[model samples]
Target chain A: MSLPRHVIAPAIAVLAASGALLRRSRRRQRSRNPRPASTREWTRHPVGLVAGREIRQRLRSRSFSISVLITVVAVAAIIVIPSFHHTSALRVRVGVAPGTPSATSALITRDAHALGVVTTITSFPSVSALESALHRSVDLAVLSSQELLTYGGLGASGSSGSNFLTSLSLSLGQASALSAAHLSPSQLQTLQSAHPFRIVALHPPTPRRSVDPLALVGVIVMFMMVNQYAQWILLGVMEEKSSRVVEVLLSGLRPVEMIGGKVSGIGFVALLQGGLTIASALIASYAVGSPLVQTHASWTLAALILWFLLGYVFYSWVFAAVGSMVERIDQAQSLALPFSLPLFAGYIYSIFEASSTTVSTLYRALAYFPPTALFAMPTLVSRGDVGPLGFSVSVAIDLVTTVLVARLAAGIYRRAILHTGSRVRWGDVLRRGR
Target chain B: MPVLDISGLRRRFGDLVALDGLSFTVASGVVTGFLGPNGAGKTTTMRAIFGLVDLDEGDIRVDGHPVDAARRQRFGYMPEERGLYPTMKILDQVEYFGRLHGLSRADARSKGAEWLTRLGLEGREDAKVDELSHGNQQRVQLATALVHDPDILILDEPLSGLDPTGIDDIGAIIVERAREGRAVVFSSHQLDLVENLCDVVTIIDHGRVVAHGTVDELASAGQPRLTVRVEGDREGRWAASLPGVTVSEINGGEVRLVLEDHVDTDLVLSAARAAGRVTEFSLHRRRLSEVFRESLS
Candidate 1:
């Protein structure tokens, strides 16, 4: 903090005098007619200053430096490894009855391939063989009947055999009735040509797990990243408070500004890391030149970034304020334990929802809360549970939660930072009486 | 007008009366030393005045108005424990403080550099704060307090870790600030520095003001008793025999005698001459330290 005497002396003298002069002017006004001192005009918010300091300090630390490297590698691995994956496209296996060497089999084979399946057809002559074949069903199959003219689809369920069975029964009954009544030949021909529309489509209950795999990956990734970075905010605040440097800042600026600045600055850094991860994942994936990159992965990555911001804001204040309550760095983790509970729950729930393709009301409720929203919303978006309306609701809730929690945290910090004897009690902090 | 106007301040921490009716005033352009022993509420008092600590009773005003948002920005405070970010570069830390005190970015940066130079920390501006010697850290701390050009500086234990050179660095800067008409208040255990630097002092003990006002006023209140020694007076038993005199010490050709305050100086001198040639005479106006120690005890 020094310069040579020659340069510093003049500058000091000028500054010292000017500072004195400015002070005198303010004093002179009060002497003539005093105004209230606590007025808003006197406020010099410490937000930007403290935040900028925290950011610059943290950026220079070994942790942030190391974390940057880790984030890049992790992102690269996430994107590149997926692109190189070999077992992604879905396929199916099938079985065919023996002695069925015909063009009908070739047509069925062609249709199976078109339906995103790789099929294999084999013979099953005996009941045991047929049962084995049924167990290894190729999604659908053709079965031969005893009578040549009147045959039925067997073993395979639904329309596979229903229409054929209906036709066989009709032929048998028609033959018996013809023997009994000597019916007209024109009517019989009419029945044969009656309705050439014999299209039978089999419907199965929808697949139990049809949720997009891409959405699940994105939602899980985002939830984990946001949770990881919110802790960064917590740990950052704890560092500042424990070092007591924040006290020097508090003297000049209000706690709101201080906390706000810290959240913004470090939050910006966290946001950058989150964005970088997404970008790296995209770039590496694109560089790998996988065709599926844009089809689904891109949207999930974007949701992850947005979720990071909303989540950071909500949890940062809670963590930051909780930080001020305790004075030592050693106590930070324990103090942070309760605050991170909601976040942890959100992360776990999101993962469960993604894998099971089933959303929980608790997770949805957590989503509306600011701290967990960063995790839940992105998960929902990835799970296709979020649309325009749900997004609006979550965003609205996030904003409100941010404002309210910030205010609450600021109040606690302002009161507790200066009262340095012991950890502040939550009830005392919230109490109206000082 | 006084730059700081504090009156009727009373505060308590639970059952402990941390500040019992603490109040004083500081005018611009003079150094006011806040004097107190440990747990005497010196730090607490300063914090309360700066609006960092809430008060239980009475109001503290700056420039005749209550100290509040308007005036707090203009006040610079350095807490007693020497708080600073250990990892932050010297220049960055000071500049950050400047901004917190409301200096614009460019202004903070330039002023911060200028302050670093003035603090004799020019080359070390880029060095991390904790890496510097304790003395250098103290200088940086001072820079933080002064960087914003605060109208009023309330420093707690400003000279604790400073070397003689570092002490001079801060003392010179403070004297310079006071000369420029910015009110400066600092507390220190170093009695001589406070005696030399402060125009007015408030000595507190057990959360109560034991003494306040000028050095002269405190001295007078304690009394102006002088100890004199005469070469031939020997044990000064002869001086003790003198009217209105109590001898307290004797060595070689010297004798320590406490002359009554009401007694005339001429009489003591004449009595000393009668015993022998008076060699040494020292007048004591209750060394502030004595009062402080005795009060605390």
Candidate 2:
């Protein structure tokens, strides 16, 4: 489950580059008419060029930048806010008169420590000075031997403020009683240091919730990312078809190349966005010392990344074909809504299952269903509910299905793209093969 | 030898036949005008040549070989529905198409720039297609088609929606490409322009080629027509007594008469002379519009 991203990332890049270069070289050699030596040059890979255009356009778009920024900020807030609250609540500062007794100071420090708070004590010139420093320089102050002063009288019940006040008051009251008893310094020390009776539970409580935070988070990210990127492919193809640009493109490119280039171009953009989101989460988790990153994180992250890619490829082809059938944006949406049902079903089910301690039988079956597998399989991987064999089988099924889907989509796209009078019906196209 | 040969092209969209055994040859160094009414299968035939349309029955050949993807790369097409990437820069879009046709990046860029310049889109290479005027977008569409310097140009209504200057510029480019040894076949309803610009004309109706020949040949194919202009007669009242001499057109003092094959030219001349002093007399073929109308019928 732990992927070698560094090795795999660069290896995939090198392979893509090699394929492009090989295609260019082969195309050049295949040219029936060779130009003069001065004019001879290698043609670039068409899919790469098409993909490059998509990448450049998307990268430069305002919406893309804005979306990434928003995602990063939202992710940072989700991680950093809880940590900030926990650290702030445990910290307290106290002010006292200059001549305050050492024993009283020790009692205050000991009480705060027992309450699981970190206290900072400072001396002022007089009682007036100590009182004045309350809630400004310190949260609380010792105005006199008999009185304790706080700006808001210890905060609401069950808060860290109320807990600290209760502990400090009991310690101070005990010290005053001991002074009246005229106990010796050794006796006083022993009394103050005496241990409280331990209350042991007959039955220890276990955590009621067993959700895997990473899996839950992964499901949400995969759903949003896949849905978003798939829509882009749909819209892009719709633009080409509605504008009648496909005719010119088809004149020069095979339908397969066009669809392949389009999916690849947008897929890379989606990958970049997914990578950024993952990286941000990792960095923020590390910075805040969150326990969410501690359990099976590497493998879960790898699964999320792998599934995102498979999910995107599977949906993009289906969306692209739908795009080609309609000439208007509204028509595209209407047609795309039905095709998007599987994505929604998978997403909703994955989210529900990701939050449970145990995976359901239906969820496991859905992992093998190509459309829902994009969501269900990755969630299973993240939760450690699926083994390597299950994961591999799902991946293999998806890949084979993707190839078949791609062929079917390309065929439909080729046949229906040029029929402009009305939205092409899928049934008619399939039956007639027009 | 013909640069492009489309034979027995047939396509059916359900019950409607878009192309019915359409056959035609387009020779290099000649501009062939494809004439057809709406839904007469011109677009279908053109699309078939580029492999854009799957013909149920047809064979398209280029340079005596079957037209495949490689051969298609050497052909430029301007569809009846003009389209370009609205968000893409004109030069980049053109170059993208050129590269798609297998031109090197550098070559595509260079050629794209050259085509844009030739199409009078100079100084606007960076402008997006959506930012251009309708005529300018049309120019950009043509630039995409011509950027690869294709060997065969199949343009569907290339002259539609162009200003006179735009028309002349594009019309000249079409003729120039053909003169440079590229086979150019363009479909248009503008018969006058086609008649003036095309070297050969092919007229199709109901998806079949009804007439195919040189401009002069098709115009002169049927029975000869005699035109007579009388000094005093503003109408063709002089043809009343003449048999097998039917008036095809009469404008002012001139009368264009469609004569029977056995009709005597001397009798028509004597009849016109008897009515008024014969100022003009000549025999010539019908006009292209007339030929086109006749072929459709």
Candidate 3:
């Protein structure tokens, strides 16, 4: 960039006069009395010291307390609120009439078991009573050997009542046929216990998938954690720079050590907060009789925490570098936009994919990409859609990317931090590095 | 005495040359006043000494050994722009800096407290830096620099923005550090205060040392000055006809004449007498400010 003459002129004059003064000083025979020094050892673990300070400061800040409290409340509400509504287990009652076959009750019970619902059977005195009891006393009733009744149709054909009716009709017909054939007990037993053919196909149907509701919740939690903690690092670095404390710190510690310590410190606090939130969720679920407590919870939480760490470590360095470039809060916000875009994009896409039954190719592709993998891979893990190999590969990619990002961020941070007068330009810093 | 030698230092900020072949030596047990005009690289040089600025080409050494991180750790620095963590407690902030410089936690805390007390911030150690007045914050800033008990102190504009009491307090601390046999260097625009407080002054203009010597030596190096007042010479035009003497100041009937080395004081007196009956006449050595101006000019 070309500087105006107004700026260039004084600079030239200063340089010229400095050169002149240099000649003047050279002419004089100046004396040099060098100071003797002892080699004193420095703290070998400066990064740890820096990180330790960050941890203490963050813990003491009121914001950390507030954030943890808010997270607990939010996590508890997510686990507990679903148990309050229709999202919980459904209860069905079946009334059996006197004339119905003794096997009818067994069949209905078996059907309900297959559908993963709770059911209770009550024997009524007569068919009229069974009809009368429908809807009022029971959800369904067996009127006779071949007849059954419901107060209303059991939703669509795809619903529980239709399924129960189909299974019952098949069982009763087979019973009637065996009775008419007059088979011996052994023959009848052999016929009744015959196994159905195991259906295998060259081109199998796509596996059924519903969003693992818990995993969806986990993705949201992970997103919140990674985003919030990364921002904490950004704001923390900005505070040091804006307050001008960074210069003093950089004097005692290298820039890399300063930033490394900050990231590590904040990352530790983030994990602690994540653990607290997860614990609160589990406790809240248990207290509220929520089924989420039993549904592959340990593995789900472990995946969530692992991904949160990966996501945080990857993003924290970038935010720290951005923080060092700008001193004002507004400038930090603006400069942070480009980096935050990827975070927001990944979060939004993950939410969509987690909520959807069929994962798109884009979502699958994103699972392997480092930035979005935090969301995508965890979502797949939650739904049991991913294998161990897929998870490991995604994790490895993120780890490698994290290493690369840290080096780049450290470079930028070291270069930009000491330039104080105005916002340091990335181009200028990078150019200077070259 | 410990000595710091900065030789052949050069740094350019794009088109602006911040430091150009800047060199000087500072010895222990004396306050070296680093003087320069705005943009003359005083702060830049101070920063360079602490390795805050990456020199394009040069070396900074202490006792004929190159300064590295381990060496810089023992050097205390107070930048021209005062900075501290505003939300941090005064003592904790100081202790943090001390710990950064390799002090043990217990030592850092104790030394931080001691410095706070010494800087007149005894009761305010628990207060957040932002809660204090500007002068008190500056005190806290200085405490952070001193908590590590560094062997060399580089303070840039330490006296700026201080009240009379603040100035006196900080000035005394600077002198005390020197008396303790530490190599102390501070930069300020207050030449007169520098004259009184500093044992030696290194004057630089445009990133190079124009003068470096004891205050007395630099002050006495200027051509003699004659202050003459004539009874009726209100315009003070008496010395204008003299070939080698230049009137530096004129007020009412008095003029201060800056004489060239060849100028005779007797001729100056005769000119003042020609104008009017002389009311007062005296010759004195140049002030440090005059030497600073003369060297830069």
Candidate 4:
């Protein structure tokens, strides 16, 4: 599938940036100047080593591959299903009484076409026959040149059949009135154009009043991506600790480097899977010509990716720290609750608030909070409820909070990682023991 | 000069003092046996030397320089908790640890293979750690510790769970590393192995150094004893007649005697000769296990 120019251009820029970074690193590696070993150079070796291991392990795991496959299929189905339902033809059947003049049929067809509805007209021998035909074959019937009969239980309020009947009656009545006035064709045209009315509202229309389906998709994808990947990191850390592999790791590397490497490594995997899902959706939408995917495609996608990284970094550390405290998998469930509760709340709140015309006070507050910002800011931006200033403030809040949470989590992880056996309590870890 | 020197190291976990003024020096080209009873702080001392445990009141030096992260990278540590990633391949796991210790990727890979081959894990490089037997996994753990050819090696209870053959194999490896001029300090409860393999032994009890010397030096530190055998003294009834000699054991023609502090060796010899024609006579030193028990008490 072909990517639109907007998608391809950003992807190329990202590739170019990464290539430059790689070149710079290689040049540093090859530099001939004799320099004393710097701290960054020394630490980079172990951190890179650890991150490489994490990336390789997860990327090669069967579960990761299977999950990616399932997610791609699901995303493709989402993109393709809607186009099939909405893009088909809309036609209404109108049965005419057989003895009625052909001019009435002509009027019905003309008005139906003017209103953008396709029509199929059938002539019946009698009014009873026309009424009977409405039940079996026609959507509505024009009986004896005066009355309109609709099929019982077939036409609901705001249905195409009701709309077609209303347009047909108005067209017929207007033609009769014009004939009674003895207006020429040019006079009729002038009269029809003479009294066109314009409507005015006291309040201005809301910007982006229509709900963007892409943003709704973005919110759901972001919530699931962060929640799922954060748990992966948590379970991975606990497994290493429970299996005692962490002891060997800590002996050679500092706690911060190890946890940092793990977070980045798993974060990379999450991004990879997320990118695949998005690409699948884009390609599927392009293939089926779905208008939903084309609406604000570039900005919605970029926002989703940015918020995902921020959210993942914010939560993955908390999970990693908690993982270090628990000695077994069973203890992880309870410990993970407090960390995941806010994420769930934000997800539910965003889903309910994304479509509302007016933003709620709670939503505005949540948009500024780091944990919920991942859900809130993207929705508000997609809905045009947030301006540039608001978006910047939300991002700044998330970044600052991420730094603080990272520091706190690293401290706890370092203190409790080596304390094996029973689950370590937060009180004991914070107090002292190394 | 010693390769690793830990002096007056003090550490406490809450109110319990894990290491109290513990001091020792491990010189290159020798295996230093770190011996202590269960809670005697041998493990803690090893950890402190590697900079794993922060000392509340002491310092550690390597090669006449204060130990830092760079210097600590030159040392390898195997904790009492035997750890290996169960799902990781043996070769990859070993090389990963080697890289963590600051070896280049190519060097780590080659050295990892060499160590694995030396530890008799030659054909199982591709196998996951969980697939191996407990003894084999222990061997792999040692290979991981030694993969980078560390200048100093600290192994805690390195032979605790090893079978007879596994223990012998690892014992040979440890001695071989020492022969290559690497300072090796390992703690084990098997006094016999320590006595046979270590060039010097340090015994700690109650978090302090109680005894530190060669096996011969520690053994000789105890009271002098004599083992005497007389052809005609079946029950050694005549041995008790000695004024300053106390008979500790008598088995048929043999009599073991502990001499008083001021008693001369000639007096014990004369008493044995007087009782009956002396067939055997030798001065005896205590075994390491006996010395360990005495040191703790």
Candidate 5:
């Protein structure tokens, strides 16, 4: 059918207009709805209730307030102290024959100066003297004889002779160059430039991401928050049962709500603390002018938040579930210990992976496990070990794990909350008492 | 309106049965005492009504609508095992629980202050629950349950550890609430208070209803028996001679008799008068405790 431009244009315009209108209407509806809950609506609004209760209650406590203040101060000191006081660049002492190779000597001083190493060349009388000077904390030593280079039972003819030959060759080369060249400094510069070498990197290709200090910081913070709040989840569950308040709480809330609320509550607080820490860290890092953070902080922050969420979902459930095992606070200590080990492993692996991303088999296995998934994936993503699809798949797997663990924890909590003053075994909580 | 009506409820806790076939109605404008001894399932009954404990069968309704576990926001209940965050300030704790019952923060806070003032805890609202004595903590527990303006109040051992003055204060509050046409049911071992406080009483023992009715009606449920303390002819022997009457115990001049439901009290008395001069003559009826005991047995 032949269509006129005016008719077709109006039709297309109408279609576009409807699309815009629909989007606007949907946005309006969302704003109109008072409940800000997500599609993955947390079962634990009560847990948020409980966690708000705990944090608001305990935030004013002598311990909580004091500890946070102290931590901020300590972190500030740690960041500031090393940068200003690192005086290792102040000076370097060297042992070299003064007259034997003036060109080499002059080159050494200039190169050392540029590197921020203040150089002092020494005129040693013998090879032994040069060795002694080298041993006396000189940064570098150049000798005319092979004796200093060759060490043994004061023996070995070939080694000693070759070392001396090498040393004499370097010194003689310096002398000839000085004679043939323009100035002593210029000749020394030539000798120093003769041995330029490439430093071969062991790290694999990571072109998509440049190095990021905040990424490491983000990983550390995520690991810490997950572990800290997991303990809170454990302790909260234990307290509900211990104080015999779960019965009352459970009356209005479901098992899912109970556990979900707890983890959500503690997780919310952890996130709050984490956000504050990050903001302050960025502010401080900004103030001090850290180069990596200045460039990639936004990326670091976004990754951190993602990792924090995934990590919390992964670990918080198990902690809540395990915490359900102990009706008494004392038993909770022992019950929580096994869960702590994975967190410990997560912490260690995260730190190790920060410097280099040679992830161990254990960490790879842990990445598959729910609790440590948050911890492992962030490290992988930070160091360029993960691609987009793989990252998403890992997150999808973690999402499934979160669901399963949530159900498992809820089941465990529901059964044991009523059974006070005794430990609830994992087997019983899962298998039958369910 | 009858605020709460629970019927045909059954619940068990592994091997041991907590409640079996329990039912009762709590009416507005009156205080109802749920009387039971230790392990008498009073707490379980309260919990079951609130859906605090899962029921194996039957239902509970509030204002004629079923009180589902999901609809628990309708009722206010104080469990036997009382709890509050030891670290939370009294005002915050009360307001928090009020909010849980679905009050806005501002509303809850204001209502919390009002209730605290009403509870005579005006100055101590900022104090932590742990700082309060057990009696005051009990008061805080009460404030938390009622701060949200709930229509139904179910309390298990509401006055378990209150001092005499504390008891009087709480009793006055409960009485005031009841006067305002609220449905209030509480279980207590304090018989005197129960007698003074409740209009309707439901007594359970060994997980079964023993006696349940108005105070006077429950007392008058059994047939009247006459106890005659006489100084003349052997009263016990004479009482045994009466139709359908059995003389059980004779302590000095005192005589106890078991009379059939059909036996006339006047006939037994006349016979006792003919046999001896009655020193102490009165209609012997079962007391509330006695009625409970007899029904349970």
Candidate 6:
């Protein structure tokens, strides 16, 4: 998937020009309305200037635009391709042994219809003939007065077919027993239509284990986006430091302003790309009439975006601080390993937990922890396992932790950014006071 | 009043002391040349003035007030290691720095364009910084520092890697900025160039200011030297034997002599004329290189 040079060249030019124009307009507007001297004076501070530069530089970058385009294309493909594949009608083939009553064939067809699977039935003269027919074209086989054989084996278990087939076989067995007992048609009908015994519980029952495809997609997207964009913030900081551009910037701006502006700028770009990708996917799904849209809709989408933002904010500060401690890109990689451990743990844990109905106490606890909450809480929310109290608690914890981490990160960044060398240790940066 | 004043400044990087009680004053409307050997703390002093490096025990005052972020923003600083976003256009990069210095976007942009044009980078503003030649990139770096119309400009090694033309262009800009009543401070190893461009020279060695004065004041502190050129004597063989005069060199028809204290310079001039025919006789002020080398030693 490579684009032609001529196409890429013009596209790059247009993007760069538009970005420049947007930046120029914002700067002009800001200049036109200088804030009065007050606490709000920070609005016209150097932080905004630095952030504006970061945003303009990143938005116009070739890698950023290319990655965004790829994400949109991938999301569209995921939605549209599956819809095209499952568009045709689904049919199950049933083979009946010769002399097996026509009524049984009608029963199987009715059951399959009730389950929304169309049926094609065939009869043969002997059991061996029926077995051969089953092997040749049928999804399941019925031997006269004997057993139900499926592609899974001679038994009815483990076969990929409708539950209607299992119920039909059980009903047939009961019908045979009633006939042996010499029951009349009215008695048979009564037995066939009889309701089962019911068991009630004092508490609402937990839902059965089932995979929510939307939850799986949501968690995965959140994990990838948080990790990817956080790394971008780290790399951007490292580049500025190693290039010694930070020295010039620090001469005019405070360290806190520089770090704040950078993280916010990159974070905004991340949200834009993520939002565009998700929106394009939804549009594609709607165009293709994908069941995904019907299943997840807006709630899950909103949770995914919100959680992504929380996760990005939580991680980007840590990354930016770590980025400031290291003078080179390679040093950043080695130092980032510790910072990224929790993100990786949450990502892997959420993916494995997304489909399971019952989760461990550890997994539940992680839903409240800030580092993992971004990954864990979203899955729990999508599954309806999270209550209002739990959601609020998790959000509160995450918010508090983000503020603490941001302050800590700012402190470290302010101290270490000026001390360029092999790599500034965390302990050293923390120990050095303002 | 000095636009920038530093006193008792001290900075240590672990075991190495980069600055030791370093002090200097830069007044407006003059080019103050900051001269130092490598590792002599000229850069450290400049960075301290802008609060880039935290001082161990001293204060830097700008316009009679302690330096702060707002005051520093009014000062332009160019580090020894030039840094600019390589992928950004020349004009945009300049304007960005100007904005960082508190100029509005419109002001920064117009000022950026004006500086680029003034610095002979008019047509290359749209080119990426990396796309320009090394000298042109240096020009853009200068434009970034100057676009805000700073009250005080501190440039560290601004002419380290430029051709003669580039050096002259930058020197002219420094003089122009000073002429506009903005104090300009620049560091360079090229002593003669500094001597020609600066009204005052502050030479530091081993993290301390060894000498500080106007070029003439410093040069005339010691015994005066004289260069006497004779038309008839190609080797100047007749002038070496004069009393109280040491002939530093006799190249072709020119004789360079250092006069000791109380030596009659009239006798030396008469001796030069008596040797043959006097073509030129003039007092030779001490060159900045000689002063710098003397200070370092």
Reference-based lDDT, residue B25, model 6: 91
TM-score for each of the candidates:
0.73, 0.81, 0.85, 0.85, 0.74, 0.78
Maximum-lDDT candidate: 2
Candidate ranking under DockQ, highest first, comes to: 4, 2, 6, 3, 1, 5
Q: lDDT for each of the candidates? A: 0.68, 0.82, 0.80, 0.81, 0.68, 0.79
Return the lDDT, model 4, position B170: 96
Runs in model 4 lying further than 4 Å from the true structure: A1-44, A82-87, A93-110, A113-115, A120-154, A184-186, A203-208, A289-291, B227-258, B264-281
Per-candidate DockQ values are 0.32, 0.41, 0.34, 0.42, 0.28, 0.37
Off by over 4 Å in 3: A1-44, A86-191, A194-198, A213-215, A284-303, A356-365, A380-397, B231-235, B249-254, B276-279
Q: Higher DockQ: candidate 2 or 3?
A: 2
- In the range A1-434, model 2's lDDT, one tens digit per residue, is 33344224433553565477557745754474333343233225556767878888899898888878877676767777878776454777888776555567898888787877788888888888777777788888875575777888666888767888887877777777888798888998898789999998889774344676676777777888888888889888888987889899888777877888889989988888888888898898899887659656776677777777878999999998898888788898899998899999999988888877677899899999989987887677665566655666677688778878987998898888888887888786676455
Q: What tens-digit string does per-residue lDDT give for candidate 4 at A1-434?
A: 22233234433544565477457644654362122353237434666777788889999999899988988887788778887777343577888886554478788877777766788888877887877777679877877666777757335667665666677788777766776798888998897778767888889676547667777777877787798899988998898888887877777676776888888888889989998988888888789886657556677677678788889989998899999899777799999998899999999999888777778898999989998988987787676567666676677677668778987898888778778888898887786547
DockQ of 3: 0.34
Q: List the residue pairs that clash in candidate 5.
A: A44-A260, A44-A261, A47-A261, A47-A262, A103-A188, A146-A164
Chain B TM-score (each prediction, in order):
0.85, 0.90, 0.93, 0.85, 0.81, 0.87
* Candidate 2: share of reference interface contacts reproduced: 0.60
Question: How would you class the docking of model 1?
Answer: acceptable
Summarize candidate 5's per-residue lDDT along B48-142 as a digit string, tens digits. 67555567777788878776543576567788888777767899888888766667678889999998888789899899988989999988888
Candidate 1 lDDT by residue in tens digits, A1-434: 11122223433443465477447745764574244443214333354455566567667778776777787787677556766664443343434455433443454455545443355655557534654555446333444432222122332444423433344344544444554565588876775466677776598554565555445555555655556666776666666667777667667555666677778778767766666766776677678774436554555555665566666777778887887777776677788888878777777776677677467788777767776677677666655565655666667667666767887888888777655667778877886434
Better of 1 and 3 by DockQ: 3
Question: What TM value does model 2 have?
Answer: 0.81
